[model samples]
Target: MTSLPEDPPSAISEGDRDTAVQRLQEAYSQGHISHEELDERLHQVLTARTRGELVAALASLPEENAGTTSTIAAAAGRIKRRGAWRVPRILKVESAYGRVRLDLSRAVIEHPVVDIELQLGTGRATITVPRDATVEFEDLRTGWKDTRYKPRARSRPGGPTIRICGTMGYGRLKIRHAWR
Candidate 1:
């Protein structure tokens, strides 16, 4: 006798839906899917009842990178990363006396979580994250100025989380979310 068709896949939970939505969003951001496709797949993921349905929503998307750690150091200049640059899983930035600007609004971030460790001697640093991202700077230590960040009341349901850590000696750090 058939074993009840292998007991079908289990029902998708809220966490599963959230994760699927996040994967869709990431795929859209990486230019893997169009806006219209993203919207359609988002709807499908949100309304999916079983794991199979949820998996179908993300069938053709490319797998995310395994991620690697990279470092950017400067003696007395500006460290800037903008445009459609690829963001690694872990980034270490060291500057003796220069400004750091990391614009992730249009960057390609494959990892769900990104950690930025900064060692600044002086000057200001401005980091612009994606509109739906979550910024965490609780582990940062500022010697001269405090981190300037205004957290939103509610972030997107399934957005990436950016963790900022390390030390800023006599410098200011400003973190802001990208504007729509």
Candidate 2:
């Protein structure tokens, strides 16, 4: 007898649910998905407690952030995100003798929280966010490199959260916030 597959845990957090909702709304706005489809998917998103369910609900619609371009700093190269650029929810960065800078003061933030994962080898990564937004850095393994995460507040609370997680090898990771 073929047994049923085990279900994924239904312990999704609020942040994940909000992110899924944002995706559904974006899909509907893009016209790739109809109202009926969006309604069905959105219901699933709101009710979903597991990552698998959320992923399944959003599997049919095209990723709203598909057009959002990601920046990369290759060896001896520098990549920056400034001006009016789309702020991707997930940013991947790697550099050897290079730099990656992202200024979120005027960028389009699609989610409540942004996750930046990086692996640097003798390089530097800088992030500039708005003062209203909250920023946190965790699990950074910088091997004898300079690091700075100073974000002064000038705006009220209840803004988007930015989580930076990565490993640094002989590199610097600086995070600062601007009043905009």
Candidate 3:
């Protein structure tokens, strides 16, 4: 008598692959791996067919840190963040009468999702996110002008999701994806 073969392992999804890639990028940024290593691992993650392969690609990486919330407030001045800055998992921005700009094109984002809350009064705010990121601002309330945002034609799978909320009083909010 012959026995049936064991069931094949489940295949990995695009989301799974994207998550592995993100973890690898974080590890690379934190100096856990070199450029060549990151390239190799990324290739492995992208080409992985099964969960085991994906897990193997992420071996030896440090666990993610607990998410923390940060607040940035300006009573009557300009607030800007650019260059190679680290983005927290949760951020709150409050401006009474100042312009605020957050450029996240080259920022180091280690989390899968980021939450940004804004409270502005009589000031404008401009936020630039990563090219591959997904932005959501449905919960934002504006008193003067509607929020300005143009989503990517086709957002990549497994990219970070940025959630924006809060209130804008007598001001405008502009959100755009980074070009570079």
Name every residue pair that clashes in candidate 1.
none
Q: Which RMSD does model 1 reach against the true structure? A: 12.5
For residues 1-120, could you state the per-residue lDDT of candidate 1 as single tens digits? Answer: 654333333354565676678888999998999999999999998888865577678788876555568999999999999977778889999999999999987776655689999999
In order of TM-score, best first, we have 3, 1, 2
State which candidate, 1 or 2, has the greater lDDT. 1
lDDT (tens digit, per residue) of candidate 2 on 58-177: 776664665453646587788777876657878777777777788977665655577777778876778888656788786667787657976652434445688877788877888887
Candidate closer to the true structure by TM-score (higher is better), 1 or 3: 3
Residues 107-134 of candidate 3 have per-residue lDDT tens digits of 7665668999999998889999987789
- How would the candidate models be sorted by lDDT, starting from the highest? 3, 1, 2
- Which lDDT values do the candidates have, in the order given? 0.83, 0.72, 0.83
Best by TM-score: 3
lDDT of 2 at 130: 60
Candidate 1 weakest ten by summed lDDT: 3-12
Residue runs of model 2 more than 4 Å from their true location after superposition: 1-71, 153-155
Candidate 3's C-alpha runs over 4 A off are 1-63
